[model samples]
Target: MRHTFAELFAPAIVLVFSSGCTVGPKYQRASVPTPANWETPQPWRPSDPKDTVPKGEWWKAFHEDQLEALEAKALDANQTLKAAVARYAQARALTSQAISALHPQMNVAPLAQRQRLSGNRPTSGVPITLRPVTQNSFTLPFTVSYEVDLFGGRRRNIEASEASLQAGAADLENVRLVITAEMASDYFTLRQLDSELAILDRTVATLDKGLQLVTARHEGGIASGLDVAQEETLLRTTQTQATLLHQQRDQFEHAIAVLAGQPVPGFHVTTQELSGEPPALDAGLPSDLLERRPDVAEAERQMAAANAQIGVARSAYFPSLNLFGNGGWLSGDVTKLLNVSSAVWAVGATAAEAIFTGGARRAQVKFAQAGYDAAVANYHETALNAFREVEDDLTGLSILNDAKTTQQQAVAAARRAVDIASDRYTGGLVSYLDVVSAQQTLLSNEQQLAAIQGERLVTSVLLIKALGGGWDASSLATARIKPTIKQALQP
Candidate 1:
């Protein structure tokens, strides 16, 4: 039995592809030295029996309902996160575009034309008069083409595109981490301000009663007018502080609104006093950062992409093969366009190689290698920065915890002093200025404690972000695959 040209070439094509001559060095992750333990000693250890770090919704560790809702809303509505997600989608599309080179490309074109030939135009060897100058022609053609990846340049391109998509996925996770952490930080700060305002409001009421008492005493010729004036001045000052706290609260509220992708005028969080200790976060071994941090994962994926680009560049050193086939029907009678008598077809192949281009190809290979090296360096830098962040937050939380303890003691002592000073002034043993000083000291201490608590919460969120915000590197493998609709919906 006779075979068509396509059938005859099939075995040769398979043999060439099966040789698997990938042009560049196989990819291996760049080696990075990591410490066996974190730089800062952590009081907390991973609760998981497997010693793995947290994954998925790390914010739930705080156990705050309002915070959980805010984080959820931010994930759903944040514009930055939406943009990152769109970029990931684009990367996935580009990867598919690159992969398309691995398969045959088919397209159809149908043509109908009427044209007139010039009667005076030259003909082959001898001139002849043109007859029936005007004519109608109709054809419908189907063409298929395939590039045989003999040296794997197109394969490397697909590899690079897949790696880029992985990097994009990691970037999306990083954005989600940032938005959620920002929302939590802003929420905590706003709550802290609310607590401070409540403290000031209570202080103002106490001063109000003191002012009335002193005013009555002055009118009865028992207390001096100077005492009444001092009490009034302290009350107004405390009120001013309340106003300041409200101002801070307003700013944080607006920031939270932006994070939640809501209009500032429409978004409002009810006044809830700050009340929570920073949850203990486990700092796993430094090596864990390779898998834990999304930024680090992104850096590593980009390095892989750059490495694949080197392969693509190196493959340019070899020749390329393109196979093409055309099948069509042509007839003067439009109704007979599909008839066997009207069939026309062609099959062919082209081999191309760049014999010389100065040093452009060599320079491209060098440039790709340089890019890979840079990406490797960036990966290392990202890991080192992650370690530094975890250390900073750990130390800050530890010191802040101690400072909060001391400030609470100070607040207690200041409260006792205010009580004792007020009794002494009532007994006419000291001027009311002593009581005012004690009250001011107490308010300062309380506000300082609240501020420290807010700092600890913010640091905790930062630490979570630095540690990779509940995403693990293992997910990169899954991300390389086209995501299902359910997976696409995930934040």
Candidate 2:
């Protein structure tokens, strides 16, 4: 009249899996305020995806082969990115471990032993019938144990782990974007330094010529020795600036080398002037940033993970249901261990409820709730910061563009002043001090222009990174568990 173990567990398994019932509060994404559009002096116009949005090889937009190559090298060899990849792999492995709890566990253990029975042992109601004896026994046992997930506790754990894995993936992508942007920024900065050094070299040459003229005029009593001294001072000062520019270029080149995963002593970028403008960027709807930026995606994923953990904690309030079984052969003789008559088998179920822990379960639920609230706050904060970055870049680009134009005019006026001062000094109409002042102005204006151009490029890179470097949440949809570096790097 008693049911077999399979019959007893069959209904429980069916009900647990098919009921579609889960404990704890269901998840709903926490909302935060967002602006409808970006505020800018120049209204943004929609552009074709090919022109605005970064696609594959975002660095290609810079139109620099060296920069593109550096980006590729960094993506492949950067140590920080590799570390992020490792963390993502670790998260994936943990997710798999959590998923394992949903399935039954099976293990095999074969045991053999010798036992001794004592005649002195107490019996029910009789005198001793035999002396001490020894016996040999053998067993080949297999066992299976499974939690029914009657309240979906294990399912919630799996959910949390999966969300964590996704967050880790987002982190990896964010690191990649940041490294690539850094490499590009350094590359452009080196180029700008080259431009500045070239300007200084030319300025120094011009000053040398003026110094020679002043020295000749002073020897003929047509100019004062003070004029010669002034010209020499200007030439030497310009030479010193050239030396400093060389030092800065060296530092920037070394940074590029490190980013490209090479020894600084051996790596170098060829001298090139900063030319060409950064590609145009479009600021999409503020709402779209939530899905585009990897940091925001990561934060949102953390929130989901925290929400699932809350469910996991709430499920602790219910008893756990587990079914276990073991079947094997046992006999006094090893040769008879496999015989049907020597077979032994058993099956059973267990349910454990936390009857007392003084309020531990409630505290855990509160802890999980607090974590969820923190995650939500973090998510909103990240989104707001992202918006701020985009706006900052937008305003910077507009202002820098205007400054570049003004700087160009200043450089031209300074050049004209230098020419006029030299002509007038040679004609004995003005003192040599005017020429020195003009030359210094020209050099300073040129350096400022070069710096502004470099900053514009760096800001462009920053904007691209803020826009997620062509990454999106869809990239994590497959949720594949990539364990090896080779697997992770695969396209």
Candidate 3:
């Protein structure tokens, strides 16, 4: 029988067009329980639904220029973040590789060789005389093969890869969010140390003057040696406190340096006390905002990929279709290669069905289903945690804000008591012990205020992180800056 190339391929071409379908189940986001009746505390203002999470340059909301600069450095140079980006690139490459399965693969080989027939070799017991013959062989050949996606197994693989790539992207964004929040927390903590150090220094200076006063009064016979000794001891204790604060501040400074990807030893932050209250944040209901978290988005994408894998597993039960073709020119004379008489060609199509596998294919289907169920559970767990975090931060900020107000009043009353006690002591109306107690109370109150203020700032950063720092899943698929692999280098 004689057949034209088109006629030989006609059946397969028909299958490719007429029988293509995806057997895999369509992806649906699993239902998760969202926290209902979420309330925004009085001091925290509610925002537009669209502004659920903190948005781009969210750190700028704190109005700390140094923090903004440090964030930029981390984004550009942090080793952990760079590693995540490299992983995303690798995932993207895998996706492209999977998509390549849908199209034909072709390769060509050019050959030049010399061959000889041995005279000593038996020639089927022929009586004719044997002779040595040598010749040059030149050939050019091309081979091509393609698997038809008649059952869409290849397409299912592609779907899984693409979903995994999106998940990789979301993971990168989650890493970014964590790093930025950590840096913010560390920087504010350093500033908090600065404020405490300043408070301790003031206490030390005031105690030094009190020591001088008590010593002079003792020499003038109006005070006893005991008062002078007690005053000196108090001054030394306050000095010790200031020294300890210095050590703590240096440690926090080192942390900030590391966050900025700089050497710890030489890096220095000028002494600047933490100032002002936690900046105002856009607050809202949890249901409207939970999806903004990258971790949540990553989990959802994981489920999607697993769903596609189920389709891939089921697809293995259907028959596979493939087409193969090869053509070449061959001749002993190099100049005669590619001539019509030297041409050779072949074409074929195959449909293969796996009749048995000892239940391996069925097991794969069950395994894929289990994976999807696990992914759904993880997604729900993540969502629940997100809600919990928001509630904790909101309540924490509200209580702490109120506490700071009461603490400021206590500091003021303590300062007044110290002034009154000093006056009474100078008039010899009371023991020096009274003045010492009042001074200690005043210093303690001031230090407590600084500590509380620092906590407020740190808590604010955590709250912003909980709200997704203005990042959302909408941009998870677009990806950051990347160089494209051109067509020839890619699929």
Candidate 4:
């Protein structure tokens, strides 16, 4: 019997549609214990899901143009963030690798060689000739192979790879969030130090003047030598503290330069006291956490990948089909290698099924299922932790807001005490020691107030981070694929 090439392949082509249904169980999104609203009992509103333009740049809400600029530069230049993007692109490439399996793989080889036949070689105890025969050998061969994907194993693999690619995308966004948050926190801490330094500067100046006054009084016999010694000690101690502050500020400056991808040695941020009240932020609904949090989205995508892997594993139980074809021409004369009489061709298929294995196939299916369960557990844990962070940041901001006001009043009262003590010391009603104690108290209160103010700003930044910095999962959903190198390189 003879058959046409198309006729021979008709059954395999039909198997692609008929028996090629994906072998693994369909994936369902993992269930999550979503809350209707935030647990914190404060004035908060849900994020608008319809707001197409979510806070792509949430840092701008603080209204600091300098901060916004720094964030922009970090996004463009930060090495660590760039590494995350490269990893995402790598996953995209792997997805393409998996898809290539669906199509036939082809190869061609051309050869030319000279060979000498042993004419006197024994065959059936007969010698053809006593003389050697030399001949030219020329050959051309072509081959094709295809895995039929009859049980959908290749399709399942592609599904798994695609899910992993989306996970990479989410990871990219998560990295961006982490970097931006770090930059903001570092920037704020540096500004906080600036405010503290300003307070220290003023205290140092006051102590210096007080020391001069005491030294003059002692020289004229109006004040004790002990008063002069004590005043000098306080002034010198403040000077030492301010010197330490300068060191701390330099470290933070170096950190900022690294984050901005700049050389650290000459980098400097001008000393400016921290200003601007913490912005009022809305704590969106707990359900919004799924859409907004990139970590959450990443965990969920992992679950999908795991689910598809189960199908790929189960497909091992089915028979594997492979189509193979090889054709070649061979001739003693190179010029005639392409002649019809010198041509040879062949085509066929193989369907292989393991009749017995040491339970390896079963073990693989179990392994895949375990992976899926682990992914589900991770997803739940991630959501729970996200909720905890939001509540903690909200409580911190609330308590710190109250502390700032009380601290302001304490600083005011301390200043009044210092003024009264100075007057009394000059009028001989109190010793210079009493004035020194008042000055120390006032300085401490002022520093405490500055710290409280800085704490408020820090807490606000944390809250913004906990809220996912205005991210939305829909952006990942609509992406068909990062097909172009240009798209893959972009964050």
Candidate 5:
């Protein structure tokens, strides 16, 4: 019996050693065409390549202490981020479950029964037969089953599951980037509104004083009633604009509260002007984008998982090998269940091959291959889109910078025009209509300048988000938590 067992074990050992070669096509990182430099010139040079962007905390670039606090609060309290974390946990659990397939499964059963034999059945062979026999028995049995994985099918499944788990992690990071960007945008927008409101308030005050001057002049016969009415009209218009700005500011405040995971009714931010300059960023090389962007990394990982699925599908065409064994004690009497003579054991190997499946295996392989192809395409597309976003944002920032410069000059010129028009109207060198036109131009230019400044800041945040918010592949390497296969299979 020992020799026979050795022979069986020898063949199993050989099978295990030979199973290292996986059958399906191996995955290669898809090749993509990338440019050496961005089409738009970067104002800032790249930072130290060895220096890492603080992972999981990219909002500190704004240098706003309040913003930093708000981000920490949002990370801890936001419902959307919490949901993402839950999804990541679920994926990790699934990965562990898949890895468990590499190990054995065991079960135990303890049972008791009572039975009676028919009297007529035992009397056939005997000339004189007695009454029916009644018996009670108890048994304890243990069974174990294990798949040998001689074709690497289970290993491929495990690899796919691990890749999916990584994808989930990337998705979670992507969610964080999006949330932070949105919060920053809204915060800056609220500040812009406050600035606008301040400008409107001052404009209204000046217009009120002008209205009084026109009224006094009309009483002295130096100005007409029409001039006073126009001045009043300007004051009322400025007041109306201030009212609209207040409404906008309220809405933005409510949005910020929601983002901070606070109740709108209980949350409010004090009115403050947007005073910070836009944060400078070093746009890295185009090639580095593949490793830096979270969504791009996610797409690549999904492609790897899909490639592994093809291996799993192709495995269906091969035979499966399983080993099973069970041992127990059985007896007619419960008290005699532990007797050595009552013991029994079983051990067996099963080999199953698909004889015919009406081309189902072929169809499955085709489907899996198709899925892999689609994933590859999606990965390439996502990478390209990421590149496009960076380029577009770079171009936008450069152009907007120039626009801001030119618009500042325009604002200065408009202010001078307003001052001169006021002086000319008092000296009767120009009509009151000229003064109104110059004042309107000055207000519009100033508002545009404020809007452009806010937009530049918001776009910078978006650019940071597109760059994966200072996260990269190195972060992924450190963040990975290896899963245990053996513990997961215990039953």
Candidate 6:
């Protein structure tokens, strides 16, 4: 018995030490090319190199206290984000479970039974006899089973699970970034509507006063009925515009309510004009984008997981070793079950080799390798897309900046023209039609300016989002809510 135990334990120790070799190809991160400088022309480069937007708080740059509060509320209450968090936790638990395969499994069994043996036997050289024997038996057994990871199959599985968990965490961060960006965009849009509505209200009031003056002049026989009719037409048009603005504002208000995770009827945001300058974004070099972007990180993690899966698949070509042992006592009587004299022990080793698989094993290995290749390609593509988004936002910001400047000048000129046309018509130097045309031009330019302002703000938020919401390695480690393996394993 002692010799048997020694032999079994020896192979287990050897197997433990030899489980270090991981089969299949080692994973090397695919290199991504970085551009030296932004392609877009800039009026000013990053002004403060040291003053960067911190990870997880990029939205604070807008300097809107209300926006910050709404973002916080969404992060806490949004159902989609909560589901992502739960999925991350599940991945973490799966990682832990995969790792546990490297350890031994143990179980205990205790049994008691009473049996009666009836003897009516005709022995080879003896006469038949009838008798009954009663006996009580008790047995306590225990087992220890350990799978010897001879080819590192279990280890590779654990590695894959760990990488998957990391990907899940990155995905959760991505969800948060998306949610925050959406909230900011919606909030800014609602504010833009408020500004437009305010403009329409004032325009309507001004047109009404102008119509009253024109009517008084017609009553005094100084102005023709044509002038009164033109004035009335302008007033009605401005009122119609105000009605349209009100409808737009109401739709945006309802959207904001949904984004804030509130019932539409219970949620309300007061009409407030958009007043702040667009927050400036400091997009670092392209290489920085790869490290800072959560989606890119997620893709890299997926590649790593695929690489590990290849190892797991290749391990199937080798033999598997397992060690099983049990030691306990058995006695005919319950009173003597724990006695040393009733001791018993057993230990064994099992080795299995897949001699034939009809090509299934080879196919699996090829499949795993193919998956790894696909993952690498996907990761590279994701990185490229991230760069494209940053470049596009940068170009958009530069072009929109120039457009805003031109539009501002145009608005000023139109405003001045409206004043000149109004004065000319009152002095009988120009027709009422000229005044109407000037007012329409000014109103159109002002509306375009409002839209441009909203675009600038929305683009700024999008740029921040593309930059991965300021996420970094440090933020991953410091997130307030972290996924736990134990929490994931719960039923």
Alpha-carbon shift of residue 117 in model 5 (angstroms): 3.6
Q: Estimated TM-score per prediction? A: 0.91, 0.94, 0.90, 0.89, 0.93, 0.89
Off by over 4 Å in 6: 1-19, 43-46, 114-137, 474-491
What is the Å distance of residue 88 in model 2 from its true position? 1.0
For residues 74-180, could you state the per-residue lDDT of candidate 4 as single tens digits?
Answer: 99999999999999989978987787776577788898989897866667866445677788988899888887887788888888998888899989999999889
In TM-score terms, candidate 6 sits at: 0.89
The lDDT for every candidate, in the order shown, is 0.85, 0.85, 0.84, 0.84, 0.83, 0.82
What is the lDDT for 174 in model 6? 91
Task: Using TM-score, give the best candidate's number.
Answer: 2
Clashing pairs in 3: 54-469, 54-470, 55-470
Residues 54-118, model 6: lDDT tens digits: 66678888889889988888888888888999998888778767866766777788989898877
State the displacement of the C-alpha of residue 14, model 6, in Å, after optimal TM-score superposition: 4.4
Per-residue alpha-carbon lDDT of candidate 3 for residues 1-491, written as tens digits (9 for 90 to 100): 99999899989878765569988799999987776655646355555454444577678778888889889988887778899999999998888778777657888899999989898879898888888989899989988888888887888888888888989998998888888899899889888888888888888889888888888888999899989888788888888888888898888888777777888888887888987567776656677565688888889899999999999999999998778999999999988997999998999888999999999999999999999999999988988888888778888898888889999999999999999999999887999999989988998899999889999999998988888888878886574223233533343
Error of 1 at 386 (Å): 0.6
Candidate 6 global CA lDDT score: 0.82
RMSD, every candidate, angstroms: 4.1, 3.9, 3.5, 4.2, 2.9, 4.1
For model 2, residues 130-216, the per-residue Cα lDDT tens digits are 788899989999898877887888878888899999999999888888898899888888888998998988888888888888898
Model 3 accuracy (lDDT, Cα): 0.84
Worst 10 residues of 6 by lDDT: 474-483
Candidate 2 stretches greater than 4 Å from native: 1-13, 17-20, 42-49, 124-128, 480-491
After superposition, the stretches of candidate 4 with alpha carbons farther than 4 Å from their true spots are 1-19, 42-54, 118-133, 478-491
Ranking according to TM-score, highest score first: 2, 5, 1, 3, 6, 4
